[model samples]
Target: MTDAPLPVRRALISVSDKTGIVPFATFLAGLGVELVSTGGTARALREAGLAVRDVAELSGFPEILDGRVKTLVPQVHGGLLARRDDPHHMAALSAHGIGPIDLLAVNLYPFEATVAEGRGFDDCVENIDIGGPALIRAAAKNHDFVAVLTAPAHLAEVRQALMQHGGTTLALRRRLAAEAYARTAAYDAAIARWFSSANEVAFPPRVAFAGSLVQTLRYGENPHQAAAFYRTDGRAGVATAEQVQGKELSYNNIADTDAAYECVSEFDAPAIVIVKHANPCGVAVAGTLAEAWDAALRCDPVSAFGGIVAANRALDEAAAEKIAAIFTEVVIAPDATAAARAVFARKKNLRLLLAGALPDPAQPGLAYRSVSGGFLAQTRDAGRVDAASLRVVTKRAPTEAELADLVFAFRVAKHVKSNAIVYAKNRATVGIGAGQMSRVDSARIAAWKSAEAAKAAGLAEPLAKGSVVASDAFFPFADGLISAAEAGATAVIQPGGSMRDAEVITAADERGLAMVFTSMRHFRH
Candidate 1:
């Protein structure tokens, strides 16, 4: 049986966001519904020439603690929590002169915004709405007899219900009740996150992650799995990006796009990173985005097909033209020129995203991963290596050109999967082998790919010839370094903490290759 609509004889509205309060209150008043509100809401209704009874007048108690304890009084809670079906509850409210509140409209203060604005601790603490949450919970618990409004966006539905049924349906009340509880949970989560950050607590006893639904994807990694994208209030990556054109982003598209964007952001100069299967297939830094795109694609043209491309700088017509020529899945950048956007508009199915800003590679943040029963949390890998930090292990030090390529290759390896091996020449990835079972196998695979790429480009020599090789971690054995030497790599860069470091250094010296140790490992597993 459809539950009968309950008449809204009285509504207690206290809103921090007064977007449609006046009009909504006016509508309620027109329906002969008594408008009882608190503080600024009552003042707003009165200013709009509507009758409103303040909570102070209804409770017969003055708002104390600078309005903090205004709605916390028993009269307000009793009216909200009372059950109309329960005689004892109705009798208690009547005995205390507390009329039942049929409707409640409330939105919490701007605590999240205040924290995002980098407000002081005191200011942020003051913005936490204690009374608002209590009132929302009370009304939500008694949702059987009450309708709750958590946002201004819900006003229209409530207004329509009042106009058609002269009250709210039980279904609408339950839905709004769910939304109210979710809003309070999200608000409290934001507060908890901010408090932990303020106190420098990396991992708290309890953690709550909140996200707003951005879009429901057609499918996940495959067609059988369901998926949706949710946005958190952190980072300027794919989550916060604006899609200018093309079809909606898929689950795999978003994942690869984020990987490409994060890899591209590692470089300061004009750079392009092409990612496939959430791994960087190719990466290059050049003087222009067009040049970077060409070099990056040259690394693994086969893999670059239908891959996600990311650029560190704004896209120009030249870069856009080059990227549009291929069957790319998605292209993301900080911005794009109008001419570039026009070029991309031709590709109807290609997704183009502008993130507005690039994420800071050095910024401190947390990374989370799920396991069987629990999740793992760790700080983001913001570690970087420079020329000054490099310790030459071989007798012959790397030349200035080799040093530049070494650093470049190591940065690329940081983004590559574990057992990663990257070969770089002139700040462009020549070959990359990632997520292999063995480091030696990764080196051989990278060398083989370099030769294949060279053949694809119709070059006589392999791209790894005279290039610098970088390993994400130390060489467990000398075989990996030997493989790089055989591939014609003249310099090597690795974390250099292996027990067989001496043997690896000996092998590099024997191959007449320069080797440097970063003393910092980057294992992206």
Candidate 2:
């Protein structure tokens, strides 16, 4: 009812994570505030030579059921939830010998950490705090009269406010109450997700997801929108990479860097992938990262400029020197040598990220996207094909070299946007066309790109000559296949599940091209 600061007289402190708890309680006690705590916290405060009152003593009842029913009594909630501005609330407190609790500092059990550590089910269940969330919610619901702290980070701010205003102000109480509710909500979401997984429920009737804020970006995709980054999964990649040097990464940089890293991780050999606007401009595998870079950059030199580059192995000085020669925005790898770091230091504005390790390409995970009213969730695109999985659908079978490039091109096509077309020779991409409405248009665009790259390199012939072509989905008509054949593609690989599959195979055989069908379709959007 009023915007006045309330003086703290009685404060309760209980925390599973005891970081900075003793000093915080000591500060509160110095202000002549009574300190009431529970089991381990009370013992800790007493051992620190601070006088403390136990919750059992305040409620006049002993803790039972392994301390599960300690602070759930009416005494605790009545003190936290009662409205101090009401005459009836004061009368009820006076009639029951209840003292108003002005401040509550509590942190829930380490359920998230327990699950992350792969602990046993019983241990994880035991770590779930029962009384902590109840206290937080009650205190937050009565923010006009009560203040609650959910994390140790909140202690410093509250301590500062108390020192400045001589207590917690109404504004500070409202802010802390909002944060308290958010912390509890995220905690509950983690528990719900874990339960769904443990029960083998692939798609639960009700699902919850939570994330921790990693940073606040300067802008979103453009300068007009605001955005922030959050970490939801623990898989290693751009989200978890450590920046060694350069300016702060933008939203586009993070997205493009993630795409490049995921594309590179698909290869076991030393590899490099160059991505621009979240699509792979080039990708290659070789004996060394330096060689891979050269081959990958040769795919589309014009588009490789200012692109995000990802390497599957540790970066050496040779590779770093070559990458630094180009105007690259970001370079990500598992690790870097000292000489490589020195080479990158000259380009102060180029971001260098070391991810410690590459993410597993075949690991089972979930992918989510926001829709109009809700979100869409599905399993990650981890399907892969090998030489043995290929079915020869043409008169002539592909040569050994063509077979290897077919698999390589299909893998790169998996990371490209659909309708996708990729042309690869040896182990490197020569041309890539993505996100077109018509498959024929994508094939034609890829051929044009190959010709432009060849002209830029002063070569008489385009790199797509004798290369293998891969399609992300089944070809609805034979026109796309004809385009590849006309571009001098000697072999083709695609998912065979369209109504015009017979017609397409007839066209491939007539063109004297080797074609194979992979039952799996990789349609990335």
Candidate 3:
């Protein structure tokens, strides 16, 4: 409440992440604050030439139970939780041979990291700290008298506050206490979420999800809204993707990059996917990265400008050369060859991200979206189309080549927005229309965009000619089916559950187009 600082008499320091611990302990020791630490922390401090009282010595009991029961004793918690303002609390602390612990710096065990490394369940369980959370909560609860530090990242500010105000300020203590609570809460939540997921329980009676704040962005989708990026503690994905070059990624860049990456991951072959505004502008799979990039670019070279590009394989010089000529915002791949790296180096403002490997799109996980009232959480869209589930809905059956292209477009359609239409030939997207409200309009737009893109590239023939078409959902009316046929689509694929499916299939038959219906529908919004 007051702006006054709280003087430190004694501090407890234990950390799994020892970053900047020695300097911090030395600074506190210089301030004449008695340092009490447990096990490894005590040994670390002693080795650093700083005198530290072992928790065993202070508690008058040796650490037992594999060094886990050292700091859970009443001697430590009583010192941290006692109220200095209350006479009874002070008398109780004194009667129990407990000295006041004015500060607590503790970092919990790396359970999240252990789990991420594919460690066995027993290893992960052992890494979850019990006493650490207890100490953090006790000191944080008594913030009026005790200052707490939960992470090594906060050591600098804590030490600075001590130097600036002769000790930690009440405001700083309150802030650190809030942070400490957050750390423990998120730590527990991560463990719980992991358990729930591993146990195959999608939703437990009580569920909590947590992420560590990675960075504060310049703004949200727009400049008017503030935003921050958070990532799972140790799991690596697009959220934790490292930018190897270029300017710091913007909010839109991150979103588009993720879209591109996820789309590219749908392919097993060497593939390239270009994304703009979170929609796949182009997608292609080929024998070589260079060929894939070229075919993907041919889908819509104009839209590929300033787009995010993702590839499933390591980028090669051949692919990098083609990309170097284009103005792209980001390139994401598993890795890059030396030649590729050299080629990309010329484009300093182009961000290159090495994701190590593509995240499995089929991996079961939760996806969240915020709504005005609250939020909507659902399992990720990992739908797949197989020949077993494919039905020939029209009179004309698709050829082997047509079926392959139809399947390719169908996979790409899954990444497109609602009312999506994708046209592909030779496992490469030729044109795409996404996010349209009307299904017929999407079909028409796909053809028109194909023509426009062809003209931009100085080609007289539109790329959609004789291409296979895929719709994310079934056509409600014959108009949508007729539109795709009119665009020179030789084959059509969609989930056929519409009331007017008969009319739509009849239209496809009239146009001499091979039509296949997939039982599963993928409607991305």
lDDT of each: 0.94, 0.94, 0.89
Better of 2 and 3 by TM-score: 2
Estimate TM-scores for all models.
Answer: 0.97, 0.96, 0.93
Candidate 3 displacement at residue 295 in angstroms: 1.7
For model 1, residues 23-74, the per-residue Cα lDDT tens digits are 9999889888999898888888899999999999998999998888899989
Tell me model 1's lDDT, rounded to 2 decimals: 0.94
Backbone clash pairs for candidate 1 read none
Q: Which ten residues in a row have the lowest lDDT in candidate 2?
A: 202-211
Q: Roughly what TM-score does model 3 have, to 2 decimal places?
A: 0.93
* Candidate 2 Cα misplacement greater than 4 A, ranges: none
Model 3 over residues 362-429: C-alpha lDDT tens digits? 88778888899867888999899966679998889999999999889999999999889999999999
TM-score-better candidate, 1 vs 2: 1
- All candidates in order of TM-score, best leading: 1, 2, 3
RMSD of model 1, in Å?
Answer: 1.6
